[model samples]
Target: MQVAIDGPAGAGKSTIAKKLAAVYGMTYLDTGAMYRCIAHCVLNQGGNFENTDDIIRIAEKAAITFDGDRVFCNNKEVTEEIRTPLVSRHTSDVACIREVRELLVRQQKAYAKDHAVVMDGRDIGSVVLPDADFKFFLDADVLERARRRKKELDERGIVKSLEKIAQEINQRDDNDRNREEGPLIQMADAIVIDTTGKSIEQVCDAMRKYIDGAKA
Candidate 1:
């Protein structure tokens, strides 16, 4: 009973996935955090990110563990640390590497082997869990997505210019779409849900109904 939620950043995939997992009494896996953990390590060690080989080695040696909503890197709790702007910029770069993607995708699959898991990421449906019992691709307009992200950052007391944030997101979208390995894409069988004006609960309820029908 795996539910794979694939979507771009700030589309509420994380919030929806967590609620969905709780509804199903399943663990929630955030695949992006795995790359963030690796990127954090590489940056912390003063390694050159441009050197893909070094990043790969760092990724292979790093140990990232997800326990509930918490994330541990090398046995140290780093759930919040990896979400910093520095790590955010580097994570997609790390995720683009074939070796790292293979490693993390394997880890993600292993986490869902027991089933009854809710996993969310850009490529979960198209790449990681194509056969998941329920698959959904969440999306929203670019401006709406940026607004959501701005609100989250505002809550954290980290103020970023909207112009800069929009630029970054657009660039990321391009890279995510063009990446050779596990690019962000909508699977043909995925149920596309536009979340432009919907609240988190509204989106969750819709998915719940879909899941219930599938189960029925």
Candidate 2:
């Protein structure tokens, strides 16, 4: 079983994807983390984001893998490193490159071939797993999404103004939607869930109903 969830950042894609994966006994693949891995790689190497060739080269040579919730890039654990604000700001730089997305998408597709996976990202449903058994597009108000992101960062001891975070999210939305490569999009067949005022449990339970009904 393959489940593809697509949404902007902080729409609870990762959180809900993990929950659904566990409940259904499927592996959860955070495809956004894979792109972040490439971004983190470029930063560590002191490569320029504007240099698409350099970014692509870094992505080509980076080895990214996931173990449970931990993310590894080139054998180094970067679960936390990739989530830093710095990396988050630059992730779209690498993700927008055609070569970079192609490289990561290949890896994502290969993993699904071997495992019953629940994968989430900007382009998972539309590009990476177009024929997935289930496709969901999760959305929330921009301010609500920003609040969720701020909460996560606060828990990590990273403090940023809510206004600034909301601005960044808006920028990210534009980038994800406008990028030339595999962009973030909601497929017509996908189940669209507006999670503006919903709790994680609420969202998960709602999705479970759909899956359960299909199974029945």
Candidate 3:
């Protein structure tokens, strides 16, 4: 069974989905990582990010792979490189490109075709896997999300003011929701989980209940 997890930035979709995948012995696909990988490549190659044609060309030729949590670009490990503040900002911009989303969506679909996978992204449930066996929309208040994102960056020794982090989070939400190719939205059938004030294990347990019920 394929599980689609969709959420806005800092909603814990990736964390929860990774745990769910491990619990159920499913393949975990970090769709965001794919976009970030492309973004990393674009910046490294010094391409004009505003040039859609150039961006798409780089995306199409990108050789991206994942070894557990480590992301490889052209056989070079860039797991840490893609998570930098610069690439983080660039990823938000690159993620909205129509051609980029199309290419990744095709790859994401192919991954789910023959695997029991747990995939998470902004548009997974609503666009990438509309018929997924299980779907979830995880969310939290803007402030709470900003806090989580700050903590994540802090762990990487990247410090930024909460106000600035909040601003970036809000901007990303707007772009993900307003983008033309695959706007982010909560699907009707998806189980909505408010992740505010909840621990990772708590969220995973709540999701587990639903996965268990559905399988029964």
Candidate 4:
């Protein structure tokens, strides 16, 4: 089984994907983290974002893997490192590179070919797993999404103004939707779920009903 969940940042795609993966006994692949891994690598190497060649070089050499919830890039654990606001802001830079997207998408596809996987990202449903057994597009109000991100950062003692976070999310939305390669788009066949005021359990249950009904 392959499940593709696509959405903008902080729409709870990773959280819901993980939950659904565990419930269905599937491997959860955080495709966003893979891009973040490349961004993180470039940041570490002091590579310029505008230098597409340098970014592609970093991406080609990036060996990203997931062990449960931990993310490893180039054999180094970056689970927490990639979640930083810095990496989050720069992920779209590397993700927009066509060569980088092609490289990572191949890896994502190979993983799904070998395992029953639940993958989430901006373009998973529309690009990476076009033939996925199940596809979902999760969305929420921009303000709500910002609040969700602020809460996560707060838990880690990383304080940031809600307004600022909202601004950044808006910027990210623009970048993701406008990017030339593997842009964030809702596939026509995807089940759209507006999680604006819903609990994770509620959202999960709603998606589960779709999958369960199909199975039955």
Candidate 5:
């Protein structure tokens, strides 16, 4: 079974998906981290982000894996490394390539084939797992999303200007939505949840109710 959660940044997809996977005893896949892994390689190897071919090459050569909460690249632990400010700036670019998305999406689907998995990202519902057992599109006000992202960064000890983070959030949202191939969009059947004021448990509880009732 596949439960897909598609949403923009900081809408609590990662937090909710991880918890939901634990609840269902399913594998948790973070597709955003896959993009971050590619971006990390592009920047670390001095590859030009503007060169789509070069970025794709780096992505192909890079080995990305999620063993529970840990993210690895080329058999090395990069769980914390890719979440840096540098990777954040370049990840959008890396994710925009058609070839890269195709590559990663294929791998994600392959992993979900033999087991129940909860995968979360921008295009998971529309592109990666259209036949998912349950789909959700989580959204909140732009201000709320930015605030959540800022809080996360602050807690991680990554100091960044609020104005800059807000601008980047808007830019990424626009890019992800407007991209020609596999843009970030909600499937028509998706359950839309406005998580602006909801606690994590509240969100999970609602989803759990949906899952249990549907499978009952």
Candidate 6:
């Protein structure tokens, strides 16, 4: 079955999606990683995020592929490159560009044509996979999201204070919601799951229960 999980930053969508996908034998696609690749490539080319036309051109020429958890851009392993603070901050800008979103959204939809995938991103359910067999919107409070994001950065050797991370997370939330292209809004049919105060297993169990209940 095709599953689309959409949510704000640091909501644990990727982790939950991967585990659930493994349990059901579905392909796990991280659309955020695709945007990160775009951001990384454009920055490498010295392209500015404010240059919409240039960013669109760069995105059109970008080729991204994933091997398990690793990501590649134009045949170069960029898994670590894209997670840098520079790329992380600009990834949302790339995602918000209409033409950039058009290109990646097309690619994301094509993947679903040949495989059952569990795709997670800001607009997966609302735009990329509206007819997904299962749709979920996972979210948590800003503080919790900030804490999770800080931990992710710390593990990668990128040090940033909680207050700074929280500010960036909040700014991203505004950008995602206000963007004209594929704004991050929950779909009417999506199952909203509040992930605050929940462990990974607890969240996964809740998702699996939703599937079982729906199928029954």
Residue 149 of model 3: what lDDT?
85
Model 1: ten consecutive residues of lowest lDDT: 161-170
Weakest ten-residue segment in model 2 by summed lDDT? 99-108
lDDT of 5 by residue, 1-216 (tens): 899999998799999999999998999998999999999998889999899999989989998987889999999999999888789888889888999999999999888898799999999989889999999999887888888888888999988888888888888899889987678898899999999999999999999999999999
Return whichever of 2 and 3 wins on TM-score. Answer: 2
Clashing pairs in 5: none
User: What is the per-residue lDDT of model 2 for residues 1-216, given as tens digits with 9 covering 90 to 100?
Assistant: 999999998899999999999999999999999989988999999999999999988888999888899999899999999999999999998889998888888988988999999999999988999999999999999999999999999999999999999999999999999999988898999999999999999999999999999999
How many backbone clashes does every candidate have? Answer: 0, 0, 0, 0, 0, 0
TM-score per prediction, in order, is 0.97, 0.99, 0.98, 0.99, 0.97, 0.98
Q: Please provide, for model 6 over 1-216, each residue's C-alpha lDDT reduced to its tens digit, 9 standing for 90 to 100.
A: 899999999899999999998998999999999999999989999998889999989998998999988898999998888888788889888988888898999999999999989999989998999999999999999999999988888998899999999999899999999999998999999999999999999999999998989889
> Clashing residue pairs in candidate 3, if any?
none
Every candidate's lDDT:
0.89, 0.94, 0.92, 0.94, 0.91, 0.92
Instruction: Give the C-alpha miss distance for residue 13 in model 2, angstroms.
Output: 0.3
Score candidate 2 by TM-score against the native: 0.99
Question: Whole-model lDDT for model 3 versus the true structure?
Answer: 0.92
Stretches of candidate 3 off by over 4 Å are: none
The TM-score measured for candidate 3 stands at 0.98
